[model samples]
Structures are given as structure tokens and as C-alpha cells.
Target chain A: MTAASATVLITHPTGLHARPAVKLTKLAKTFEAAIRLRPDGQEGWIDAKSIVKVMGLKLRSGSRLELAAEGVDAPDAVAQLRALVERNFDENV
Target chain B: MTADTVGIVIVSHSPKVAEGAADMVRAMVGDGVRVACCGGNPAGGLGTDAARILAAIEEVWSPQGVAVLVDLGGAEMNAEMAIEMLDEGRGAQVRVCNAPIVEGAVVAATEASAGSSLDAVCAAAEELCQ
Candidate 1:
């Protein structure tokens, strides 16, 4: 609803692999918003709604990212996303 | 060994693709185990409805347990939901394994079903990723 709720981006050295991407997609689906991700200098946003699209980014750790969620749940979406990246998707750790 | 009957469900963007992958693996194992493919129009593709796929998994395993193998990401979600449903419906008697549909996965699933424990089946699947 607000520009402040557009989206948030985080990059992990591991990038978003199978497990983390799965978690993120599931969480994103809970909110009434459209989510997208842009991996540093890449044109066009990737659909965060689709796990395949998110995985297609092949993001690795240290890759700066741009995450944007537009909708009533944008803020929450961004918050959760930040948490997920901060945890490095908890990949088998 | 009490003759454990393990079931497999393969989901992919295309039904034929899933079937083809299964067929390739079956070529090596034959009909020794119960293998089912979900997805694709003709195969009735588990209907994007998690419950539907879960029902199919339950039906396939019935009194026993099943090890589910799904292709791609969305199908994995569908598989996860199916496993949860089956677990709730059948309890510990029904189980699910998340494994790739690649050559190694196919080989491991078939071998594990032959005599290995569910944990082993899962381990075999994990080995493929390595």
C-alpha cells in the first residue's frame, strides 16, 4: 500500500537453494501480495511467487539482491524475507 | 524381511516426462515394486490439489508406506502436502522421501525399495545429490 512496502533484498553467499527457496515461496504465498526479486544489475524482476523462478536466479552468497513485495502484506513479506536471508535459508545447517 | 511394498509418485510439468523417467528406471527394476506417476493430462496429474495427490499416495501405499519422488519445485510442494496428508491419514505407517528424479535417484529408489529401510531409501536419494 505504501512505497515503503515495495520490497526488501538480501544476499547470502550460498544463494537461495532448494530448501530455502522452498521455505521462502511457501511463506510468500501466505501474504496477499505480489513478490519479486532482482539480483544486482539484472534486468526484469524474478517472480518470488514461483519457486522455480526464484531458484532460476541461481543466487549465491555475497550476491547483492533487491527484493520487492507489493501489496497489503508487503511490509510483512519484506520482514520475513530479511529473516530468511539472515538465516542463510538454514541450508542443512 | 516381511516383504515391504514401497510406492513411488513422480510429478513433473508433463505427465509423459514423469512416466518416461519412471519407465527408464523400471527398465532396470521391472515390476518388482509399485511405482506410480502423477501429472500430465492423461495420467490425471494429481490435479494441483495437494489433497488429491495425497489421496493417490495413500491409495498406492494403502496398508503400507510410500516414498514419494517429485520433479521440479511446485511438484515438490505438492509432494510435501501429500506426505503430510498421508502421515495424518496413515500415521507412521506412511512415509515420504524427497529425492531428485535423476539417474542416481531412480537407481537408489529402486534398490532401496528392494530391501533397504525407509531411512536407507532416503539416504540413497540424498546420495544422488552428492
Candidate 2:
């Protein structure tokens, strides 16, 4: 598969918390796809697979984020990514 | 030895939580001291196995004895398990203190990087208990 991907807007009120970022990074690394997180208005892309990078963003709840995944597993990756975020990182919605 | 840097381990149920704690530490201390973290799973994650966490702890503690900070009760269990799994020699160098990870990470990263001792880090954590 060509590097397929999708970007989802983060709608959780808390944007993303540390525990959630760690969960996202941990899940993201499970697939062959490369994940990059671009915080709103940020010039650089952080490795969504890196816990440090995810937490470094310090995203507050309700921030809009773009999650890009590329590689053979990009489809499943995108689906799972949406599930994780939609689950509000397993925190209360 | 007069310490130049300290090794820190953060434990939480979620790896992200632990990493988030470390991120805060990095902001306070920069790249001076080494930091590692592990999460406990009901089933467990791929690299989050016991061996992996123990190795992460040993890797960071290569320079000096490590000071462990735990976020939750389970974190304390994982830290102890990591220490127990260490080689007798390596295990001797580990110090798993019941310090406040949220507070201790900030203080340890800042003070330890500034040449503070593990005792000082523990003291900083103790202050949070009050």
C-alpha cells in the first residue's frame, strides 16, 4: 500500500493529557505506519510514536490536532487513532 | 562520588503518564540527568514487559544509583519488581524511594542536574507529602 493517511481533529475537552499521549504513542508504534503529530500552528512535526514528543506538546483539552499515519497499515492505523481519541484517551468525554 | 547527574525512573499504569512526568522533568532539568519510565498493564504491552522495564532502569542507572519516583501504588510495585529482577550487583545500586513523581520529577531533574544528591531529591519529595 502507498503511504495512506488521514488527519483527525482532537475534540476532547482536555485536548490530550499525558497518560493519553502515552497511550496514543504506544498504540501508534504498534503499526508499521509512521505517525507525526503537529500541534496547532507549530512549525515542526513531533514523532507521534515518541512519548516524550507527545507529552512535550502539552496539549490542553479541545485543541485541534492532525494525526498523520503512513505505510501499509495506514488504514487500520487511522481507524485505531480515531477510536483512541474518540474514547477521550479512555478518560471521561 | 560527588554526583554530576542522577538517574530517575517514573512508574505509572500508563506509559504516557510516566513519559508525561518525564517531560515535565526535562523541562525543569533539561538534558542533564537521565530519565526512564515504565507502565504496568493488566495484560502488559509489547516492550513494556518486566525485562524491558528492568533494562530501562539499568540503562539509566549506568552512571549513578537511580532514584525512583512512583505515580501510583502499582508504579511502586513495578519499581520494586524492576529492582528485584536486577543482577545482584546492579540491584544494589538501585534505590526505589516512595517519592512523589509529579513533584519529585520536577525537583530531582532540576536539583539533581544542579549536582544535588539522591537524598536531596528524596527530601524534595518528602516536602510534597505535607
Kindly state the number of residue pairs that clash in model 2: 5
Instruction: Estimate the TM-score of every prediction.
Output: 0.48, 0.51
For model 2 chain A, give the 10-residue run with minimal summed lDDT. Answer: A1-10
**Whole-structure CA lDDT of model 1:** 0.61
Tell how far residue A34 is off in model 1, in angstroms.
55
Error of 1 at B67 (Å): 1.1
- TM-score of candidate 2 against the unseen true structure: 0.51
DockQ per candidate, 2 decimals: 0.01, 0.02
Best by TM-score: 2
The global C-alpha lDDT for each of the candidates, from Candidate 1 onward, is 0.61, 0.68
Summarize candidate 1's per-residue lDDT along B1-130 as a digit string, tens digits: 2337556566666667777877865654456556666664334553344665666575557354566676677777777766766545564654445556744336444544455556655655655455
Q: Provide the lDDT at B31 for model 2.
A: 72
DockQ of structure 1: 0.01
